[model samples]
Target chain A: MHADPKGVLTGVHFLDGDHACCEGTLAAGARFSAGYPITPSTEVVERFAWRIPTVGGIFIQMEDELAASIAIQGAVWGGAKAFTVTSGPGFSLMMEHIGYAAMTETPCVFVNVQRGGPSTGLPTLPAQADMMQARWGSHGDYAIIALCPNSPQECFDLTIQGFNLSEEFRVPVMMMLDECVGHMTEKVVIPEADQIEVTPRRYTKLPPEEFHLFEPREDLVPDMVKAGDGYRFHVTGLTHDERGYPSMNVETQDVQVRRLQDKLKPLANGRALCETENLDDAEVVVVSYGITSRVAQRAIQLARAQGIRAGKFRLISAWPFPEQRISDLAGRVKAFVVPEINLGQMVHEVARAAAGRAAVIPVSHAGGSVHNPDAILKAIVEAAR
Target chain B: MNQVTLEIPYEIPVDAHNPVEPFLRMDRMPHIWCPGCGIGTTVNCFTRALLDSKANLDKVAVVSGIGCTGRVAGYANLDSFHTTHGRALPFATGLKLANPELQVVVYSGDGDLFAIGGNHFIHAARRNMDLKVICVNNLTYAMTGGQTAPTTPDHVISATSPYGVFEPSFNLVALAEAAGASYVARWTTYHVKQLSRSMEEVLSKKGFCFIEVLSPCPTLYQRRNKMGDGLDAMKFYKQVSKIRHGAPTSECALTKSGEIVVGKFVDRDRPDYLELLRGQMTESLGDRYAEPEVSCSC
Candidate 1:
C-alpha cells in the first residue's frame, strides 16, 4: 500500500464523466493504460495518459483499440493492473480479444463508455443499448463480469472493484459506462492511497516446475504466473485441460466451458454480487442498469412521493443477470418496468426472471437520448394501478 | 562479456538437413496440413527466420488467430498463443505491449487477417506498434472448406464464390503501406530464401512490420483453380514471380499468373506511438514525481 500524501477521501472536486472515469481508474491501482481517442471516451484516455505517468505508471495512446486492448493485456501479464477505455465502435473492435482474455483467464479491465451504435450512430451522445451486447457480443459460450456505474463516484469505486474482481476470478472484468456517466461531471472525493485496497495478481508460491497456467485450484480460480517468471506454461484459446494444452475431446471441452461459466455464475446468485434498492413491500419495480438506473431511481422517488408504491433495482453487476433477485422480487411486485436506451433488451431478462409472476413492460428509446424519468414514472403508475 | 570461440572443420549441408529442425517440434511431425499445402513451406521459412534473427527464445511469444496458418504457433517451440479468429493481431499487440521485452509475432490466414480482422490490421499498421504480423494469403478460406476470402481475386472461384468472386482482391503490400506500416514486404514459397529474408527483416524492424506470404492451398485453392499439387504451385511461382531488388511502389500489385512481387516496401521510423506518448508524459510532469491528481470528478 502506498502512503496517502493527500488525506483519505478529503478532496472534493467536480469533473466531467470522462475525467471521473480516468481518476477512478488511477485510484483503483491501474498502473498501465492503453487507449485510442474515440469521441466521448477519448477524454478518459487523455486524462489517463496524463494521470497514470505521475503515479509511476505507464499510459500509452495506442494506434487503435486493438493495439490499446493488446497493450493492456500485456501489461497485466507483466504483473501490472491495467485497463483500456473505449466507446461503441472501439468496443466492437475489442470483442474478439475480450473473448481471448476470458478464454485464457487473464486478469484485466476494460471500460466501454458507450455511444449509440450498431455502427457510429451517435458519437457525442449517450446510450444504454450496449447492455445486451456487452454480455453476448463475442462469439462463444463464456461468462464475463460487467459492472455499470450510475454516477462518477460509482465509476471511481467500481473501476477499483472491476480490477479486484478481475484479479480474484482471474478473468477480464468490464466497467460498462455510457456517454452519460462517462461525460457527466459530479463532485467526487479521491480516497487516500493507503485507504484504497489494491489487489495485486496472485502468483504461485510453488516451485516453477509444478506450475500450471490453467490448473484451477480448489476455489476454481487458478494462480497465474507471468511469462518471464521461469514457469513455462502453454496457454491457448482452444478448449483445453488443466495443463492448458489444446483438447477437443467433448468431456474436456465441457469441463473447460463449465469452469468459465461457473466462476462468475455463483456471484450472480449470491447477495454480495449485486445491488437492489427499495424493493421491500413494493408493488412496482423498475429494473435497470448503467446510466438508465439513475433515471429509474429518480422516477421511483417521484412515484413514491406521488402516493404510488414503487422501487428500483439497480444492477451493479449485469452479466450473470440478477436472475435470483428478479425472480424473488417478482412474487412481491405487481409488475417489473424495464427502462433502457435500447428496445426490449434487458426487459427480456426481466421477463424470464418474472416467469409470469408479474407483467414485465419494456420502455425503450433508441440511440443518443436516455429513457426519461417521466416515461419511467408513468410506467410505475400504470404498473401500480 | 566473456568471449568463447570454437572452430568446426566439418562441411555443413547446403540446405542444412532441415533449417527448420532447430525451432520445430519434430515429434509433432507430419503436420496437419494437406498434401499439396504450401503452409508447411511458409512455416519452414518462419522458423528459419527466427533462428537467423536470434531473438530471445524465452521472450518470444507467437500469437496465432484461427485458420491453417494460425496453427504455426502450436508447431513452434516457443511461448505460443492460439487466440480467437481474426484476433491474433490484437492478442499479439497485448502480448508485445505488456512485456515490451518480448518479441511478439502474429501469424494468421487471409480470412483471419483481411476479412474479419481487416480493421485491426490497418489500425495496427497505422499505429506502428512494435510487433510483426505475417498474413498467409492463400487467396481463399481453406480452413472453412474453401470459402471466399477478402484476398480472393476477382473471378476466382471458391465455395461461396461459385460464380466467380465479384469483389476485387486487396493488395496486402499496398494496404500496409497506405496504413503506415513501418516495414512491409511480400513473397511466396517459391522464393523460399527471399521469403525467409523478408521475415528476418520484419522481425528486426522496430515498429509494426507486415509481411504477406502468398502460399498455395492445393486442397481448396489449387484444386479449384486447377493449379496442380503443391510442387506444381511452387513451379508456377518460380516461373511467374518477377523479383526486383528495389521495385517501384506502383509495380507491387499482383500480376496475372499469380506472380509475387518480392521486396521490402516501406522502412522509415516515425517515433513509435508508445515512445511518443512516454516523451509527452515525461515533459508534462517535469520533476513533480509525487502521485498525479486523481479525482473521480473532472
Candidate 2:
C-alpha cells in the first residue's frame, strides 16, 4: 500500500536520527503514540508530539514507561498504527508489556535509543548493550524483529520497515538506535508518499460467526479486527486456543508458543536485512551493527591497506541474527572480527553461527562511547594472521 | 452526562429472555470465578445496565487486568481485552483516545486498580479521560489466595497479614472523586438495583466515571475473616448499609464490621482529555488541524 500523503513529509532535509525517526513514524501512518520521557530517546517523541497534532494524530505523555508501552497496544487494537519510545531504564520497565504484545500478537513498534545501562549508567552516551535484551529481555520463548540503523537516513528508512515487519508478522518490532546515532545530525532524503510503501493491517474478511481471533492463517498470522467493528473478538495475554479463550493446558502451550518462533523462520533466512562487501575474496570479516558498524568500516579499510583481505558485514536486522548468511560466510572466511559497544553480546551469536569452522575474535568496549577504529583493526589483523 | 435520546422506561420489562446470556461468552461458561464470589453478580448488574442504557454493544470495549474480578473481560462477549495486571486504565485510555467513538470500560479488581495500577488510575482520572471504570472491590487479592490488599480493612485477617492487618484500606469513592473523576459512586452486591443504576448512569456519561462495587470473596476474604459465606456477607451488607445519596466521601471509609456507606458521592462537569486536546489543537492550528480519522478505512 502507498504511504498516506497526509502523514508523509515528502522532501529532503537535514535532521538528527531522533527527528528523522519521528518522520518515519508519520510516514508509516502511525496516528497514536503514548510515551514517557527518557534520555537519548526523548527527542523521538518530542518531535512526534510537535508534529502529530498537525498530522491528525494523538500523542499522550503517559504516567510511566509501563503505561506508555501497553497504551500503544490498546491503540493498535483500536485500529490505529501506534508506537512508544524509550531508553535503557524505560525499556526495562516495558518488558512485561512487550511480552504481552508478543503473546496477544499485537502489532506495534518500540523504539529504544540505546544508552549505557545496568541502571542509570551514562544516559547521554552510546551503547549497543541492548541488542541481546531486544531479542530475549521479555521473559519468554518468543521471537521479535530488531533493526539496527547506522545513520540518520537509515533511522528514517528502517523505522518504516520496522512498522511494516511488525504488521506483517503481528509482533512488536524494536528499532534499536544508540545515543550517537540518535543525537548526531545528518542529511536525510524523504521520497514522496507514493514512493514509500507501507504494509496495511490484515483485517479478516470472515464474518463474526466464522472468525476466530487467534486462528492462524496459512501464513501463521491471524487477521485482525478493530474494536467497534461488531466482531466481538476477545484477545488475552494468557496461553489461549485458536478461539482466543484461555486454555491452560500443555497442549495449547505447545501450539501457541512454537508458532511465535517458527513463523519468523523466513525472516531468519531470505528476508534478513544485511549489507555485505568483499566477502568472496576476503580472509577476515568484521561483523558489526549500529554506530559501531560505521567505526568497523574504517577498520576494514585499514586492514586492507595493510595487505590483509578484510571485509565488512553490516547488520541492519540484528535479531533473528541472519544465522544462515553468517554460517555461509563462516565456511569460506578464515576468521570473523566482531566489534560492538558492548562487552560481548552479538559476538556470541557470531561464534555460534561460525560453529568451529572459523575463528571468532571479539573487539569489545564497556560502553559510554563507541569503539575506536584502531581497536577493531588490531583484532582484524590478528584474526587474519 | 451525554444524554441518551431514548426515554428511560418507567418500568423495565422483565422479559423471558435471559439478559446476561447474550452478553456472555456462553461457550466459555463455567467461568473461573469461584462459587459464592460476588464478581459474577456485578457482571450481572453490568449487563443489565447495558440493556437499560441502550448502549451500542458493538461500540463497548471491556478491558481488565489480572485478578479474579479481571476475568470479567474474558466472559464479556464485547470486543474485550484481558490485559496485564494493574494497567487496564492506560490500555483503556489508548482505546478511548484512539477511537473516541468507542465506549471503553475498564473492569478489574481493587488490588489491580488501587495498588499496582494506582498511578495510572489517578493520572487517567486527573486527565478526566472518557472511560467507565468498574472496580469489583473484594477487599483482598482473592485470585492469589486472599493476600492483604490495599483495600483490606484494618484488623482483617489475610494470608499476608496472619496476625491481622494494621494498615488502613482505601476509600475508593473518595480517591476517585479526589482524583478528579467526573462521576463517582459506591455500591455493594446486595444493592443490585442501585449498582445497576450507577452502571447505567456512568455508561451515559462522557468523562471519567468510577463505580466501586464492594463484593464478597466467599472462599477467601469472607472465610478468612470468619464471615460465614456469600449469603451471610450479603445479609451483613443489608444490615449495616446506609444509603447516603450525596454524602462526603471523606467520611465513608469502611471498617471490618462498621456501617457501610454506599452512595453516589460526585457528579460534576469537566472536559475529557480528547475534548481539551482537540479544542487546544483546533484553536492553535485552526484549519490546519484535522481530527484523526478512524484507522480502519473499512
Top lDDT hit:
2
lDDT of 1 by residue, B1-298 (tens): 2223377688655565556766765645667899878888888888888889987777777778888998887777677777777767766665665567778888889899888788878877877778888888888899889998878887777899898888777888888888888888788888789889988887777898888888888899878877788889788888887776556556677733655678776777877756765666667766654432221110
- Expressed as tens digits, the lDDT of each residue in A1-385 for candidate 2 is 9999988988989999999999999999899999999999999999998988888889999999999999999999999899999999999999999999999999999999999988999899989899889999998799999999999999999999999999999999999999999998999999999999999998889999999988999989888889999999898999999999999999999999999998888999699999999988999999999999999999999899999999989899998889999999999999999999988999999999999999999999988988889999999989988
Give the alpha carbon lDDT tens digit for every residue of B107-132 in model 2.
Answer: 99999999999999999999999999
Q: Could you list the CA RMSD of all candidates, in the order they appear?
A: 6.1, 4.8
lDDT of each: 0.78, 0.93
Interface RMSD score of candidate 1: 6.9
Model 1 C-alpha lDDT per residue in residues A201-298, reported as the tens digit of each score: 77888876687778888878888877655554567788877867777899998898889988886677773355566778788988888888888889
TM of each candidate vs. truth: 0.84, 0.97
Q: Candidate 1: lDDT of B290?
A: 40
True contacts kept of 1: 0.37
